[model samples]
Target: MLFFVALLVDGILAGSVYALVALAFVVVYRVSRVINFSLGEWVTFAARLVGTGTHALALPLAGALAFASAGMAALALAFNHVVLHRLIGHPPISLVMVTIGFGAVLQASTVLFFPAGSGAISLPVPSEPIEIGGLFLVPGKLVAAAIAGLGVLIVARVYRTRTGLALRAIADDPQAAMASGIDIDRHVVLTWSMAGVIAVVAGTLSAAVWGGGLSLVLVGLKVFPIVVVGGMDSVAGTVVGALLIGVLESEAAGYLNPVLGAGFSSLAPYLVLLGVLLVRPYGLFGTPGIERI
Candidate 1:
């Protein structure tokens, strides 16, 4: 019982990280229908910038975060506006492959520029752990969770407001939305900006939780499962899926390793994803089509 409780706590923390990343994935997809395989590279780029700014250049932590996020945000906006917008009606598969290629380029560029392979660097965020009833909790993880929750609320509320309602109208029908005098380019840019900020937030919180580096990109990758388990469009589903994967993976590593071996522990989420795909197809909260033939 104690073990399960501990697992739940740890899972919630880890799941917060996953939720943030999943949120990033969903944001871009919701607005532009881009999968953005390059998101991991964006995370790696932000981590490298943060480490360099704070450690190498002797900048203050707040300044470093601002610089890193700004750099990533600009790059994301450029990538979306210049490169992707040109391919607006291209085959989805082609766009996805292009993003994957772009990610490789960014990763290679980071290796050349930083010369420090994906080594871990301490985050500027506070890292002291808090204890409750013998369970140790990292404050950084809780902070990340709060930020993710706040982001969802803000976005939802914005959608409820006049401007947000306008965006939704665009989402519902881009042609009509444009004909209705909505600035389509501005909307697309806003979507990219939102996605970029979300990605950086995930990278920063992850740097605090697991340390900063290229390996932190895996935080984004692990979130792919969360998006799969939850519907890509469902923010609540992402949060719940993140928590479930976090606790289950941690518990497996802690207890099942003795019997199932260590190598299999990390694959738990993928297994869950495969099972979910087989059973639910669209995920826990994904849409069910009402086809009329």
Candidate 2:
């Protein structure tokens, strides 16, 4: 029982990270209706920036983080104004393929810039573990979880504001929003910028926990199951899904891994995604689509 409790706690904390990343996906989708497959590349790019700022440039922790945030935000805005902006009114398939190509470009760029043999980027957090009632937790993980929770709160609060309402209107119907004088381009750019910030924060915190590496891009892929299970359009659902997936993954790692061999935890989220799709095709909070032939 105690062991299970520990697993649960760990999973919740880890899930918080996924929740943050998933929120980025939800935010972009809500506004632009684009899947933004290159999101992982953005995250990888931010992580690399953080690593370079700290390790190579020798910037202070706070400065490195700020630099990463600004850099990512700028990159996102540029991608929107330069690439995506030109492709407006094109087929959704074209945009998706462009994002995929962008991700490949980012991956190749990272390899070119950082080259092979780049070591782990060290975070400023202490190496000590925190003990709470006989349970030990990594300080970095705890801090990251706290940050992720705060991010969720901030985003939730934003949804109540006028700007959020405008974004929501655009999401509901772009044509209607444009008719109402809501600048679709402006809102899309703003949404992309926000997505950039979220990706940076999540990527940096994840790097703090696991260290910066090329593989950090995979974090974006992990968020897919999270948002899908929670309902792509529902922020509340995203939070719940993240927590559920996190705990289940933790449990699988702690108890099932030894018996089932390693890697079960990694596969747990997808299994849940399949189950959710089969049972609730629209997701827990997603509105069911109706079509008449």
lDDT per residue, candidate 2, 1-293, as tens digits? 88999999999998998899889889988887777787777777777877777778888767877887888889888988888888888999998998899989988887889735332555557879988987999888898999999999999888889998998888778889999999988888888888888987888887777666777787788777887888888899999989988899999999999988899888988988898889997788776778898
Quick one: best TM-score, which candidate?
Answer: 2
Score residue 149 of candidate 1 by CA lDDT.
66
lDDT of 1 by residue, 168-276 (tens): 7775678898888999788778877877777766777677677776787677678777877887666678777887888888888888887899966688899999999
RMSD of 1: 2.4
**Where is model 2 more than 4 Å wrong at Cα?**
115-123
Q: What clash pairs does model 2 have?
A: none
Collision count for each candidate, in order: 0, 0
Candidate 1 least-lDDT 10 residues: 117-126
